[model samples]
Target: MPEPIADFYAVIPAGGIGSRLWPLSRADAPKFLHDLTGSGQTLLRDTWDRLEPLSGPDRIAVVTGRAHRAAVERELPGIPDKNVFLESEPRDSTAAIGLAAAILVRREPDVIIGSFAADHVIRPAHLFDWGVRQAIAVAREGYICTLGIQPTEPSIGFGYIKKSSELIVEGAPEAALVERFVEKPDLDTAREYFADRSYLWNAGMFISRADVLLAAIEENRPELHAGLIELAEAWDDRERRGPVVDRVWPTLEKIAIDYSVAEPAAAAGRLAVIPGHFDWDDVGDFASLTKLNSHGRGNDLAILGENARILADTSSGIVVSQTQRVISVIGVKDIVIVDTDDALLVTTSENAQRVKGVVDALKLTGRGDVL
Candidate 1:
């Protein structure tokens, strides 16, 4: 139909503590700041670059903790200083997104907003732009649009979106009405979902008008919405925005957007899933790193390894230092070898999934230096 609105805004939520990619991805330096792919660009920078064309620098906003504001600013220099909204303490995605909605709704009342993670990789900018336009079109019609990726395999690490009958959005050929939102399932359940043909991996990318999202928040989670409204009102007061965000953020209950809002909206038939036909990867943990890097051969060096023979059977392998340090491996397979300047990790690929456990142990044992 008509050309999509040129005044669309984007909000990136980057407040997570990234414990899974420990040692490298620390509390001070989240995964979004790390160059996980060994590409010069960090994940946050990559995402910003991808969204630049659609919303430009001034129109984009990043919601993160005060600890990460400098890093986020460093990653996205093109963004205006006022656009970087900072929370005093760490809050979950729901709070971060709600705060963003509150702030953006004030500036551009009818603006369509797109909320995405700072650490996902979706290739081919053209395809991503197209998908965003379609999502925006659906959102303009008062429907909360979420991008659901076609699962490449049975992945239990990610949540799934069950799609109902196809519905027509303005620009998209076919958009599926979201039937239900499923949490991370067991291996057997994941396989069953894969067999259904209607389930897609929830990409965590959402689009909707500011008012629509606020309405969804009000309907699904009244408490959260009330908190958001209070925060928004306080934010309007110049002296209060800074002090209030710092004071009240940590007190907000930690909940994901899916659990707090998306699931409820889907159940009420207010959510729709748009098929995103593009390469998508959350790069959530080191296991996900190997899966994304499966195309590389011998030249693949993770952290500090040289000429290392790494055969990742199940998307879990070594994360070595790339400082030209030589690390040799022979007859070793299905292992995660992480070499840092201070710490070394050698565990089975299966055990690699428990890196968060190591992070917790480090925290419990008061070894914050390594963490």
Candidate 2:
């Protein structure tokens, strides 16, 4: 049985459109709204399911764009209507999360709030819960705590967190004082970091007391903090929320929480990381998605949507076919074929990270229909 955390409030920032997932993930219908895992539920739905059990439905809130409000509501039916925070525009993670922290502070004053991205796919629920519990315990000690993923490979996709030694925080034996945050390193550097025991993948899972988080933002990103505070003060007032947010939200700087708070806070020794050994994937590209599809069960070909529609003959790689179309690949290795009704993408599984370039090309050609 899942018991609610005493003063814990969950904040899920479900804003990204996941341009790399292209035809499957669109602007109106973002990646978070889709079932990328084929787990019978959308990513946002899965995220809500994961957090609701910890914080209880009422204590969990979603911060998303106004454009996605209807979709978010439709997806998470149990979410309180008041808990849906609608942003005027895309202001990135800092603004979205700062807005949530401010609002939670307005109500509970010193509540514990954890911000998790909706698009990530984490497995072995119990392991994730344990790590989050540790993070929460560290957050209660007034540190901006993050759940750092133990790297299984020398993956360059994620930022790395360097740790010197463990903290003496009670109830969090695994928590470590973050030395510094290193950006996504090149292949050589990534390999070096992977070999280093102290380096952990920065999972971007932020847990902190509402007041502590806002104070960090005030010290690091004063401009964003000001706008967020104003928006938060108006948040409880239904009639004033739209007006004040419209006036102030666009003026806030567009920066990630990593830059606005995490790095700076870590420099001041205000950040701690609880190492998470659970299987975690941000699902940033098709290559990772293919790996997820091929997990546990061993098969020659990786099929995401319809296994019946995909036929492979001496072929290996990923195929995402969803148009009731028969896709047959013969003698091709490491090929990635994604078939949608309107747009089809063909690339090697190795070049999956470059899919964002294709999206940019479409934008340059003014192809909004498929974007």
Candidate 3:
């Protein structure tokens, strides 16, 4: 017999413009639609597929911008038309999640909800499923459950979650009470966090019941919660959706769920962190893409380059073009060389974080042709 299906709903936020991954990931097509892992499946498709066993197609909802609706629909055909919630304007993650919570509250008030980013790449599907199951049970108990990745390095790109007391869950690893939430720290601070062994990298994956999340929002950000409740009531009117969403979204403060909700919830003793051992990467910037990319012994992704020497200590390279083109490099190391139909990017690996700078310059110079 097949495994029992878990009763939960999933919310995927895919509203990022992904300027750092330009040329391949553009305004018309975000990074979630691109196959960053070269697994033939886009990141959005991968995320949806991972949640199938837990929630199935009907329980999945995608919250994205109006500009990305068609792309999302084309990528995931299994999702129903009503499940795709579009924002009138681009808002921060807090508002995006508030809209999702409102939608969930309308349909199923007591339902457990899992909110995640659409572009994260996590491996070993079974491990992720297990983590979700544990979180679901915790959420059922009316506590906010967040998946916290065990930090493998003292990297400064991600925020940290400090755990205080341990709560034992039957048939699962120990869940910890979140003592504090720390922002991205410098190298010295990161090393201290690692030495303490009480910190976990905040993966930004959250699970909670609809009412539970609404209550948290109400307690932390009353204005945002009120606006969401109003939108939820007006959503069925059809005529009110456009005007209400337009007016309310701009007025809602632009804050991340971590700062606006999770931190405060932790301080109030309503937060728990589940140990997430899955191989996960947010793939936030171009530098992260390199670490997640597939690279062999010498970290080389060679394409149409004969007698070329490409050496890299890290996984960092992608080459794409329309026609057969002869490209060669000699005695080069630690760089990203992307060759597209109309554009090419050649930058040192260390400068990968500044890839967005190039995109901004292109936009400023009015080079719409390449962009």
Candidate 4:
């Protein structure tokens, strides 16, 4: 193992609109900006709460769109205003993460950086920290390491990582080489992966040195790498950055980090996977939210906000009424009712994933206010 780096930096890609949890999660206030759970804090704030301990208060940075920069800052205090990288437009995950990697290299060439999505959910802070520490350990050994959560069930929503063989690294005994990354499989394939215990749900959390990631991006997507370098050079200069960014941002390739770096790096024998032994959930849609909010009252009824305003009579489902309006359901089962001030979403839990389709329809109808 190589020498361990003491200074660690955490980057959060917080640009998603979370269309699956629409109405409550709008363009102005995305899902990460609001507390979908009863956690008393927003998801972005919760992400900071957990990562701030592993990486110090000043070492964390968030890469978001220009519209949400101020909201991200308001949620996270003590973060230097310069640490936040505001992208001019929406590129995919690759640009959001690559920007942070390029900036960290400019600051410190050897700094270890880990990226965690702002919309996921993890529990028991100590356990989450342990997984991150192990990932950093493997990452120090010149491998792009990702935390792989053991699957609790056969979930088709998440992509999977196939664990090939174990690796010996100091401070991390449970790390293994990632054989391959599998896309969301069918029901039969998902069940086989779970039963055989050869797959772990990719948490989309990755750790590596700043230089390592930059080199990979340069090797895979040279065009994006060139643009990112130009932006990073002007990152400190207020006068030149805006002009350079406006010119280069939209022209960069639109690709995910998994396609641009991780899958290719795994082919080249430069990727590793650390088993995350803690509880994790992606909170992808209303169904996941319902599962996370279940407090042993059974899954019959899961109400997120203001239970006093909900009336369930011979009904079993999930209801989220943000305005605290009286929501009455009669003789309904497995139905999902989300009532906002101006929009209402009514669907079944089984069709929760289709909620994104509703968002698409709203866009076609030019209902930007509710979207």
Give per-residue lDDT, candidate 1, residue 344.
72
Candidate 3 segments exceeding 4 Å error: 1-6, 170-172, 302-324, 366-371
Cα RMSD to the true fold for all candidates: 3.3, 1.4, 3.3, 2.3
The residue-by-residue lDDT of candidate 3 on 1-371, one tens digit each, is 22535558999999786877766677777789888776877899999988877887788999998988998998998898878888877768778888888887888767888898999999999888888888887787778989999898888888999988987666446677888899999999999988878899999998888888888888889998898888888776789888888877778778889988899989988899888889899877756676666454335653322223333333435443323555555556655676666777777657777889988899899996676
Error of 1 at 209 (Å): 0.8
Worst 10 residues of 4 by lDDT: 1-10
Output the lDDT of residue 347, model 2. Answer: 90
Instruction: List the candidate 1 regions with Cα displacement exceeding 4 Å.
Output: 1-5, 296-316, 322-325
Per-residue lDDT, model 2, residue 143, is: 93
After superposing candidate 2 on the true structure, give the runs of residues whose Cα lies further than 4 Å from its correct spot. Answer: 296-299, 306-308
Candidate 2 lDDT: 0.88
Candidate 1 collision pairs? 303-320, 303-321, 303-322, 304-320, 304-321
Please report, in order, the local distance difference test score of every candidate based on alpha carbons. 0.79, 0.88, 0.80, 0.88
Give lDDT for model 4: 0.88
Candidate 1, which ten residues in sequence have the lowest lDDT sum? 307-316
> Compared with the true structure, what per-residue lDDT tens digits does model 4 show for residues 1-371?
22223668999999888999887788888888987678889998889988988887788999998999888888987889889899888899889999999988898988889999888889987888888998898888899999999999998999999998898999998999999999999999999999978799988999998889989999999999999999899988999989989999999899999999999988887999988888888788988887887664554788877543988888777888878688889888878899888998999879999999999998999987777
Q: Return the TM-score for each candidate structure.
A: 0.91, 0.97, 0.91, 0.96
Model 4 segments more than 4 A misplaced? 1-5, 306-308
| lDDT, candidate 2, 1-371, per-residue tens | 55989899999999988988876788888889877777989888888888877899898899999889888899988889878889888989999999999998998897999999999998878888888888999998889999998899998898999986789988898999999999999999999999998999988999999999999999988877888888888989989887898899889999999998999989999999999988899989887887887765334568777443977898777888778888889988778888888999999878988889999999999998887
